[model samples]
Target: MSLILKDLTVSAGKRPLLEIPELVLPAAGFVGIIGPNGAGKSTLLKALAGVVSHGGTKTLDGAWPDAGRIAFLPQDFTVSAAMSVADCVLLGRREHLGWRVTGHDRAEVRRVLSMLDLTPLSDARMDRLSGGQQQRVLLAQRLLRDPRLLILDEPTSALDLHHQLEVLSLLKTLSGGMLVIAALHDLTLAGRFAEQLVLIEGGRVHATDSPERILTGGTLDPVYAIRCEVFRDRDSNPVVVAHPAQGARAGSLER
Candidate 1:
């Protein structure tokens, strides 16, 4: 069982924003979308999540997916004030919720809140919470659903370093059960957590390979215009260190 895409394409007016003739994503794994800014990483995720209009034949397990069964959290997604944290997360279960709230609904909300360390502030208002806390609440909302596909854009963008590491670790663990796709800017971190990496360039997939293969200087230099080196850590994860690419200009990567 895998997510299959065929003839997928997105256009902004007449200029094409993204195009993927064919792609197959593993059913359960962490796949990181890695590329420079404006490389169409977000566009690709939005298309799969149905947040944007695009032309494509996207199927899960050879069949069309149920919209309600997919959980999506955009990078800049925000919520207004005047709502309790618990209530905000509970909204995620709306597809399965009845006219009356069920014990199961409350139980599920409690579970995700605990998973994201939000139970202590579950009663507080969403507007009163800190940015990191608010991000966690939104993530908890998405996790409350028993989704088959989980799509996120910069899932750790709002969190501090410690919390970012914690959430990435959790997402990696969860990917063992369901598909998890995220757009990551930190090459080292992406290499460490992602089982596979989709390297996007100029609105198309330049490469779909393991982080070890995609994080090398030879692979990234042309795309990012930087000179970088890749090494292994104690845990055998790829670690990337990059600098500005060399040219006739004043700024260049140092030796």
Candidate 2:
């Protein structure tokens, strides 16, 4: 269930978006991909999910992951189908179902819906739900896949603080038997939850380690081009506070 990448490169037109010489991720843990915007976080996830064309060798457990073993949730969950929440969630079972969805599939959908607190909205149309609620429904659909590897891009962007914690906590629990990789912008939350942090900058991995090692100003200041202070919370977990330093170079990260 481990993921290994070698000589990986993802490009758009002539500009490379992501490049990794070599990296290995464990089978079961919450891994967070953190970086400033346009740092190729989404591109990396897309490469792993096989949604983007790239040059690399990505193997799972010493072999390529099965097609059905990987499930991905993109940053944008816009769906114009007007499908019901239940129906959208049930689509996860499409690969497993034949002409008709079996009773087991239906039950699984219900279970996932309950887990995501979407039972009340089961019959609600996707277009009618708020952005956050729609995101939850999409997540329920992905969870129903029972994937060996789950990749999410900006999964909490549409949720409130309460729902953000809830979703991340749920992902942490789900990582017990599978790999969960998420691209996150909230460095504090990433530090608090992720077992490991992959810091990306300018299409390259700047660092990879525990949150305590990667959240510090020394490690992050270069990538983000901002002054950052890393401290411990009451629970002794690393907390990062970032602000622009006086006379800081403008557009440094962009260059």
Model 1 per-residue lDDT tens digits across residues 1-255: 888889999999999999999988898899999999999999999999999999979998778668888999999866777799999999998877889998888989999999888899989999888788888999999998877889989998889998899889989989998899999999989999999999999999999999988888778888998877677888988888877777523222322
Q: How well is each residue in 206-243 modelled by candidate 2, as lDDT tens digits? A: 89999887887778887888877677778887777777
Off by over 4 Å in 2: 248-255
Measured on C-alpha atoms, candidate 1 has an lDDT of 0.88
The TM-score measured for candidate 1 stands at 0.94
The local distance difference test score of each candidate is 0.88, 0.88
lDDT for 158 in candidate 1 is 85
